[model samples]
Target: MDRITLAFWSLVIGLCGATAFFVTGIYGQQATQQQREAKLESGDLVQLVKVIDGDTVVVSKEGQPNATVRLLGIKTLESKHGKDEVAVYGRAAEEALKRLVGDKPLRVLLNTPPRDRHGRTIATLYAGDQDIGLGLISQGHALVYSVYPFASMPVYLQAQTTARANNLGLWGDPEVSAKAEAMINEWARQGS
Candidate 1:
C-alpha cells in the first residue's frame, strides 16, 4: 500500500477504537444507574441486630452475612468508637437509633456505590414508617452529611435545619463545636 494510504487507515482505526471506548463507558454508566434503581426498588429486608450508633447499624439476613449499614446522608455523634473519645450528643444519638431500629424489621435501599471502604452498607434505611436517617436528623440527633449519594437530600437538609433551630441534640452546644467535623475531616485526610 502507498505510504499516505497506510497512514490514513491507521488514523481511521484509532478513531474507531476511541469511539468504541467512549460508547462502552457511556453504556457502563447507564447500566450502573439501572442496577442501583433496581436494588432500591427491590426493598431488601433485614433484621436489625443492633444499633452501632446513630449512623451505623448492624443487621442480619438469612443465608447472608451480617452487614453493617452506614445511614446515608447523615452524620451522627461518635457514640461507639474503639479509640477516639465520644463526642457531644453521642450517647443521645445512639439511644435514638436504638429506639428507631434496634431489633426491628428494616428495609435497606442501597446507593449507587453500595458498600463503603469500611465494609459498611451505604444505604437509605426504612424502619416501619420512618426513614431512619431522616428521623435522626429531624429529631436533632444527627447532621446531614452530603459527602455521598444520599436518597433524599432535600428532606434530610430540612430535617437538619429543624433540629438546629430547635437546639436539639448536637445543636444545643453553646458554640459551634468542631469535634465531629474535625474527626471526619482527619479521617478523610488520612484516607481512612
Candidate 2:
C-alpha cells in the first residue's frame, strides 16, 4: 500500500480501538454503580460511616461511595437550629443513635423507590435483628413519622405512645415534653 493509504488505515484502527475502550470504561463504571445499588436493595450489611443524626446516617460498603441514609418510619428533633429544648433533645437523640449503631455493621432494608426527595436513601437500618428506628421511638429519642405509610408504622406508633405515656427520654422532661408534644400532635394532624 502507498504511504497515504497505510497511514489512513492505521489512524482508523487507532480511532476504533479508542472508541471501544471509552465505551467499555463507561459501561464498567455503570455496572459497578448498579451493583452497589443492588447490594443496598438486597439488604446487605454496610459499615456505618457516620451518624448524621437520629434519623440520618452515612454508610458504605467495601467498593462503594458513602450513601446518606434517611431512617424510615421515624424522625428525630433537629440537633441544630431549633429551640433550646428541641436542640437539647436533638443532641441527645444523636448520641443515642451513635450508641445504638456503635461499631456494628448495619443491615439496610431499602424502601420502595429507595431514595427520597433530597436524594437520601430511605431505609430501615438494623443492627443485627434490632431495628434502630423502633429503638429510637421506643426510647423517646425519636418520633414516629406517620405521614408516609411504612411497614412498621403500627409498631412505631405504639412504641411512641408507650414512651410518651411513661415519660421516657425527651418525653420525661417537662420543658422538652411540651415542645415535643406539639410536634407529635402536628405529625398526627398531618397524618390524619
lDDT of each: 0.73, 0.86
For model 1, what is the alpha-carbon lDDT of residue 123?
86
Quote the lDDT for 78 in model 1.
Answer: 73
Instruction: Name the candidate that leads on TM-score.
Output: 2
| Model 1: residue 180 alpha-carbon error in angstroms | 6.3
RMSD of each candidate relative to the true structure: 9.9, 10.7
Candidate 2, residues 1-192, lDDT tens digits: the string is 999999999999999999999999987886665455524665788888888888998888777677778999898989987767788889898999988888999998889878887667899999998899999999999988877889899899899999999999998999788877787788779978
Index of the highest-lDDT prediction: 2
lDDT of 1 at 156: 82
Q: Candidate 1, residues 1-192: lDDT per residue as tens digits? A: 999999999999999999999999987886564444322223888887777777887776665656767888888777555534345477788888888876678887887777676545688888887899889888878877765534598788787777777877677774433564564466456543
Query: lDDT, candidate 1, residue 107?
Result: 85
